[model samples]
Target: MHLARGAVFSLLLATGLALPGSEGSKHHANKARSAGYALKEPPLTTPWTDKVGTEPWPEYPRPLLQRSEWKNLNGVWKYQNASGLNAVQNPPFGQALAQDVLIPSCLESGLSGVQADWALYSWFSTSFEVSSSWKGEKVLLNFGAVDYEATVFVNGKKTGFHRGGYFRFALDVTEHLVFNKQNELLVFVHDPTDDGDYVIPIGKQTLRPSHIFYTPCSGIWQTVWLEAAPVNHITQLDIDGNMNGQVNITVHSSAKDAPAEAEVTVHKDGKVLATHNGPTNKPFQFTVPSPKLWSPNSPNLYNVTVKLDKDEVESYTGFRTISRGKVDGIERPLLNGEFIFMFGTLDQGYWPDGLYTPPTREAMVYDLQVLKKLGFNMVRKHIKVEPELFYQACDELGLLVIQDMPSLRPSQSKHVENCKSVPILPDEKQQAEFTRQLDVLVNQFKSFPSIATWVIYNEGWGQITDYYPEFGLTDRVRQLDPTRLVDSTTGWHDHGAGDFSDNHHYANPQCGTPFYSADSSPFDPSRIGFQGEFGGIGNNVSIEHLWKNQAAIDSINRTYEIDTTIEAWNYRSHILLGELEEQIRLFSCSGGVWTQTTDVEGEVNGLVTYDRRLARTDEKQWQADIKALYDAAAARSNATTATL
Candidate 1:
């Protein structure tokens, strides 16, 4: 009874160019899809869904390390579903798939144009001709992300396979590619969403989704594109900077054995500020004289370009520092050595239509803009890694980020049920796989200045509690990236490690003390505590905006203690923030994060509605209340500084 499809079209534009086999090439299709594609109606959808067009997320997928020449491969493509690994041992090859699916979207989402029944595996096939300009160059087939496992085939030749669901992967398809010809690109994805057989980090996804767990995001839920690069190209740029204005840049080149000089240039407003040349894969530093520091009040970023031989890539970084220091006799996280409280939201990145993916680039930007406009300064990206574009938006919008590593647990979470603490020691294979993914995550996301802290575990979801000063989880993360602050454990079962003694309370806010000092010391200023999560004020602002699934209904029914009216929700939220202000002044609380930014399916306690159409509170009053927390925090910080 609650659905709207104002400009939303129907679902499939199945008609397209054929590939290489079966009475011609049914695999290859025209990149320019006609405006005749159909759209399916979800329970509630964002306005940006209408603007997605046939080419969803046409913007460049990777903004941090961008190249000029690239093609977005996100549109209608041949598709089919399978259940077993043996069924997909041999790819469809030259054969045309019976059904059509919108590329870069999982089959379960309405945006995919084929929200078919649940399947363990899927097959996608498409064909494209490489630009003649890129004929002699190495063609890198890039996938923004594919959930679980993905095996790619080009021109019927098995090309490459990637295991992770959240991190990005690229394969040099130059060998499998037939130059100047229409090459058929096929992919097979297998996602065991919380299957008891697999222990991969599923975050909040569950096959049997309910109140807390969300609908599963399987297959390619992000952008798929192709970028031309040289054989000896710059693969990654590890960038870091500090308060002393010294910027470190490390270039990772494809041709590691071959000697090549990495030429790095730092610029602002099209003018060069600093430049350095060093050997590839080795870190080198340069001081930016009179550096324009980056902060939430003024987010300033300097662009940089790294060139190695015939390959060059563009990147950007913000100069800021995160350190632990005491304010008003309570330890706090200092932003650029000043205690700036992070009035944040617990942002679980989910969409009704796209699931794991946002509708458009502008849509993602709007989420960050919402925080910026409302006087909130941070977002704890809860247990899910977003595309680099999300981080780029945070960097540009001046919103600090506390990024959580995805957790591994299938059934009802003990942490969510408020059960007693019990460390989950995963199997050896699970440990190795999780560690591998964490390594990639730390290496991948370290470039952004907006990420103030790396939260390893949330609510002890898939954590081994006693992982301090020993082996496995916590120590490995610190070993990989020590530049940023690390929260070894978030909600409960705190292992006395990492930077923060984080706690979670429902509808009320409270702070905790630091755990384990560097030298077994009593009081260490290098540690602090914060409210990881609090305040789930549920108010369904509009019936038309609610997700009408059974799980959603059950979730609403179970909210026996929540206030559902707009006025009551606002009143409760305001009072909670006021209490948190006092906590910041008296307790060892650095800041507090509201339970959520927007409502997910079923769990309807959000500042904004699920479709992002309505705010439960009056915008002006909510902004004023949030701003007051920072003012109180500043006064406490100022008093502490005077004593120092």
Candidate 2:
């Protein structure tokens, strides 16, 4: 593994609450003293080990809006770190001394082959020869995601720069292609982590790795690829369904004022439910009486086919309504004409080995499937944006999501006050970076059907003292996709502007009496009560898997006992689970999402381990308990309706 020259020193300077000195220093010291030195190299175990490819991440990245013709450009790439300003220069290519790292995986990840210590800025270059199939077709270069900021070049020609790291960006490179000759693709990435104020929700990332925080991940961390498309191809599609069961469809194209027509057909059980035709700009509405609503239990979906002349694209849509209305004289979230409680986990979607990238497409799908199996109907995706395929799997497998806008640089005043508990950007420049990234995140995933809620801020991380300005972030999301609900704040320090009164309570799941009072009160949970984050149960199954470098069996047992009994419970893993079930039973909870889905780095409070091989809690027992709570809530709602 190649360690970045200055990373260890920089990490030493940036260590916050963790032990003095850099993690690398601690790791090296521990390695020297240990007697069980089986080999010279560190253990090569990551979430992506079994799935690494010479040409990595070969799956079709975009499944929601797909095309039949494309090429996969994910594999080893020539890499070097350069100053962000000087990255435009053409670096020496194909040199062995220069680093060779795997594509779609970050430098910090084990699967990258070159496990360099994380760097702030880097350049990646790769070459491919165009096929002689068709010379006139448009070639598009696509990036699933790149952290913080990235710039793309084709054969030394500057193409474009994208600011956000969590969203997809593409450039049409057909005009710049030199057919039948070797062409080069160069990418420059700049990720400040917490050093600068950027809207990257460096959620668990800190210079210090302890408790819930983790090691920083920077640079090009997602898939990079190239595809061929028709000159006048479909760029994007927006599908909106009304409460009246009428669906509005709009197709966007690069070709202007072309005589483009859209033929939309909805099918269920191999039978055509409805069909309609209209111009590209116009809305195509189709109605079905007593519509089959989409829910976690049934997840009824209608297949939608859109044909424009010779080009035909197929996708799916769900008929469901999410709104706020009065229930028992209090405003609460209504899902599909009924008050359904949402129980879920805060899914940061990070892996120990892969960092941001999953080992394989199946690995990504497995997380969502396991959540479903554990009886969770919803997932608050934390403060990170996932690939479209992750959301697509949620749609297909029947899961709800509360997508968060990645955190921005926190204000200095708020930063100082919350420094002990939260992660904040160290400077104002970082805040600007955070805003640009947030805009990109909102635009990219706004169209997904499974995403029912948008979270603007998590706790006080990256939050300003007066968070109303941050509500502008919520306003932007509302304008982009008004169909879904928005939570201005996920946890404490509420702005009281968005749809839910989100709260984070650990150990105890009780919503304060003042929060539920109908009388004049500041924090009223009855109005819009949602347990945004709670539960952090840590159950360490094996001593060998512990992150600590110390190898003594006795020390492992002592540490595990202290970490699990008091610290994990104090973090409220057991208490929150019990209280969460009770709150749903009492009919006071609208919906709730726990602190996390899996163990991340030093945070051992996840429901499952980082590798996702084991569950912390008894799965069958939890599922039965959750189902009982859900059933009780449903019965209460039914009885209230009967009285009406």
Candidate 3:
């Protein structure tokens, strides 16, 4: 790790939020242990374990747009259930509360200290000392994410109101701050998982959380902090780099008339490569001489610095291109103008300790590291928008991402039963909210170079349109981000809207089946043919690691006829691997994604156990088979280019 990165980790440990004992940062390991808070119940933990104290995730949350002078607000805060009927509506802010809970981790999580049920409302209050340094500048209150809805108040004044749990938002709290004194910050949150009837886009969260659906995450599940910025600072920085060496930069000022011109400098290792000056909101184009393209093998990113009047922001971008192309008579996804095959596991991004959040920053990076070590080039982030640091880790570690918009509504029973896509007719209000949330999702993650595709919907999960065909939603995503490929729907009910035809196949273990085949012939050959999901071989590990023991085991047994014993599990996994290899060779699926990377709650169909233990398949053999698929794809690309 870099010295600066180590320093950040050390600081987080000192605050009792970050896990200690990371390599090169053991000096701060005892810091968390000193704070002393025992777990209420014995919990299943990942290999990376550290005693969480007052705060469990204290590191700077947003690495893409980081400010040196910022204060992490993730620590102990007074919390109380505001869901009780007639429970003191609109209570006075800044008042002391009885219960204490950890910030950033959701209330339902084991690490939060308050593993309360999913409530209609909850209140969080904390006090902080403002330094003399933040007098003149604006103190922007930033929340990495808040589930469903959040109403924030500072010093007894309403500072901001925000909706959507997956996207980051900020408020200029400069006016509400009590200068050089103790200030009070309070947040009220509410989340009705799936709007109680599958009307809202809930994305795998359920009140009863069973099978594929997991626990509901309400309240602040991500980081919250404060930063000093100018009154009219740069609000957003959008960067788009192409394989032709041209990069376009768009700077968004806080106010429309605030800044006329902004300067953008592109550099490599502190040396200036190119510079361009242009007006805000307009694309300023620059070119890097002999730009190094980003791919799974070589992920190169040029450092970028934007100066808009008094405010300056730092970012990075990689020069790459993506499209649908033909390889060996099969439609394939092309990266940087070359046909390449993608093989990855579906990463649900759920943890036993943190639930929706990772236990620590290192925990986030470890998941990607394991995937890369297993020789997979891509990961489909299934129905979850991870913290910015997760995406940044993917960029630095060289893993491609297919981001899915979290789905809403429909019971787990309905989703499981409706294997075919059922076109949903959403009301007017649902349409507006869905459009807004999708726009936020695209804009928030558009800058990451690792993201290769924007999945509009997953198997028509939470999809809504007036008519049978769903073309408008995919078109909206294209308009929001045209740089990446868009999968209209993955697995079932192809609308023929996006650039790929996706399929999902699973062997019925109940019939003692070894393999189930899927035909991609129904899809248009002009588009990329992808096996978005397949190969779910069940292997239930220990009882403690899963959500439920007998019930989950029985469910798996009923569905896939596989016994709970280790030997039986390993035998099926062996068979599944051979079937996977055969599918890659025989089918026209240019890309394939296994059922999952890790087991979740009731789902035992993952490469690794839920607590990230016990690999189901032999790692060496699996990697060799996947590598052969990649080698064949590359050879086809080379032969076709030579013929051209």
The candidate that achieves the highest TM-score relative to the unseen native structure: 1
lDDT (Cα, tens digit) per residue for candidate 2, span 1-644: 12222222100011111211211111010111212111112122434455455555666777656766666677666677676656556444443325666677766666665555657778777777677674767788888888767888787677888876677888998877888887878777877665643445566555434445555566667766676677776676677655567786777666757868777887877888788887775545668655677778877777777777656666777888877776664456778777777888889887766767776777777778778887889998887778788888888888999888766543322245546654443345755656666666665666567888888777766776543556776787788777888887777667576888776765345442234322112446545777776655444435334443222112222222224333343344444566666665554567777767876655555666665655555555667766765786676566552221
TM-score of every candidate = 0.90, 0.83, 0.88
Residue 238, model 3: Cα distance from true site in angstroms: 0.8
Alpha-carbon shift of residue 241 in model 3 (angstroms): 1.8
Better of 1 and 2 by TM-score: 1
- Tell me the spans in candidate 1 whose CA falls farther than 4 Å from its real position: 1-30, 34-37, 410-425, 465-472, 513-526, 640-644
- In candidate 2, the residue pairs with backbone N, CA or C atoms under 3 Å apart (3 or more residues apart, or in different chains) clash, namely 146-165, 196-430, 197-430, 197-431, 198-430, 198-434, 199-433, 199-434, 507-572, 515-525
Instruction: Show the lowest summed lDDT stretch of 10 residues, model 1.
Output: 13-22
- Runs in model 2 deviating more than 4 A are 1-48, 90-97, 196-201, 242-244, 256-259, 268-271, 281-284, 288-291, 409-436, 512-522, 548-575, 585-587, 640-644
In model 3, which residue pairs have backbone atoms overlapping below 3 Å? 17-55, 17-56, 198-409, 198-410, 201-408, 202-408, 203-407
Best-to-worst order by TM-score is 1, 3, 2
